[model samples]
Target: MTILKAMVLYKQEPIENNPLIYSDIDKPEPGHGEVLLRIRCCGVCRTDLHIAEGDLRPIKLPIIPGHQVVATVEEVGEGVQEVRKGDRVGVPWLYWSCGRCKYCRRGLENLCDNALFTGYSVDGGYAEYMVAKADFVHPIPGFFDDRHAAPLLCGGAIGYRALRLTGLLERGEGSLGLFGFGSSAHMIIQVAINKGLDVYVFTRGEQRQEHALQLGAKWAGKPTDESPIKLDAAIVFAPAGWVFIEALKKLDKGGRVVLAGIYMSPVEKLEYSLLWLEREVKSVANVTREDVREFLKEAAQAGVRTEITIYDLKDANKALQDLKHGKLKGSAVLKII
Candidate 1:
């Protein structure tokens, strides 16, 4: 058995106080249908921040916190056919789903009752090596490098899923509004442009607005500011409650607004008139593997771009701190081995 160095979080605490310790652990071996991967990069998501701060309780202690992983297969277990040794792959938040569930039977595995989440429910990619079910690993597109593709596994894929939840993919010539200009919104903006839809962004900070504009958003303004045109669909990535109301107010008749974050401030008060015009609000949960496949293909073709700040694997805590404080412009990634 080989020993590998990894950053392990034994307890939930602020990142600044050495919440995660760098230690040696036995490298995980491929299981019955799993593949051992030599992790190269892992993206730090807001969910990770939540877990670290105890906002989301840890499913297991001494866990390695990461899911948006890019790695190369080092070994393959029996019964694995989709991936081979030395193949580059990406691991997402959805680790596995019970195929016997009604949701899985209906090809809606994202809602599976027995779904397992990487990093959340199992050991994840915050190490030199990790293992995953071969069928769950997605092939990285040739156009993206490991660091660049890391964020796409979760932020990009889930954002794409949120967009799909809006039913915008089937609709034509509809205005799309993104209620936050984070990494996900950046990718979504490009996709909207490729689909020939106008893009509007609502965010509080000036920097995010500039980023939205740079990504070809037709209009960008603070949440308090109003858009000149109503939106056919909107996606809210910000966890702030007020943004949701602002986005709802900007929706056209029969429009939809998808809430993309895992947790958000409570919607204390909302006027029914805002939703009385046949407008609807939907929430996006964990993504299906099919969503991963489709989003990666479309992202590759749309020339989706990611803005990332890189940190060494041992600096995973720093990455989380930066993400928590909103110091990074886009996504924060930790380069392992």
Candidate 2:
């Protein structure tokens, strides 16, 4: 058996407390319909911090915790025909879903109850070697490098899904509000602007607000600040429920807001005014394979740029700590073998 280094979470605790253990473990082999990969990079998402901090409880213990994966295939198991050896691929949040469910039948596999999630339910890419379902693995576009493409596997794809769910493409001319200027919002803003929509960003902290402005946001302000112009749509990437109400206040009539996080702070109260006038509210649980393919193509073609903070794979704990404390400016990524 090959020994590989991985950051395994044996318990859920605060990120600063060092919940993940970096140790040498037996490298996993590709099972039937699976592909073994030599991980190049893994993007550290807020969701990873959530798993570490107990915001999202782990379904299993001693699990590797990284979902935004970019790697090159080293081996393929039986029935794996989608990708061959030496192929560069990405493993996203949607690990694998049962194809028999109604949600899967409706092309909404993200909602499948039997869905297996990477890093949460199964071992993920915090390790140098990872095994992913061949069917679920997506081919990385040639333009995007391993480190740069890592965030797109989760933040970029899911954020693009949220933007699509908000129906921003439905209206050609209108303002779009982005609540929170984190990894996802930063990428989505460029796509929205490229699509000809005026992007307004609502976020706290001058650094993030300035980053938003640098990304071509027409306006950037705190969540409490009122928008000068009503927005046709909004996407709440922040985990604060109050951001939902705040986005609604800025949306025009018949507008929509999509909450993109798996967890969020409670909504204290819902005023009638914020939800009336055919305005809508929705949540994005996860990303579909279609979303991954579409976003990668579009992102590659549009030349989307991201601010990246790189860390060695051994420093996974530091990356998670930085994410938990809001120290990261753009996206945090682990550079592995």
Q: Write the per-residue lDDT of candidate 1 for residues 1-337, one digit (tens) a residue.
A: 8889888889999777868889899988888999999999999998888877788878888898899999999999999987989999999999999999999999889999999899888889888998899999999889888898988999999999998888878875778989988889888888878877788999888978888888898889987797879889999999888899999999999999999998789987999999997999899998999999888888888889888999998888888888877698679999886
What C-alpha lDDT, on a 0 to 100 scale, does residue 157 get in candidate 2? 95
Q: Extract clashing residue pairs from model 1.
A: none
Which stretches of model 2 miss by more than 4 angstroms? 170-172
TM-score of every candidate: 0.96, 0.95
Worst 10 residues of 2 by lDDT: 166-175
Summarize candidate 2's per-residue lDDT along 187-211 as a digit string, tens digits: 8888888888899999999988998
Clashes of 2: 0
Once fitted onto the true fold, the runs of candidate 1 whose alpha carbons sit more than 4 angstroms away are none
| Candidate 1 Cα lDDT to native | 0.89
Worst 10 residues of 1 by lDDT: 165-174
Return the lDDT, model 1, position 26: 98
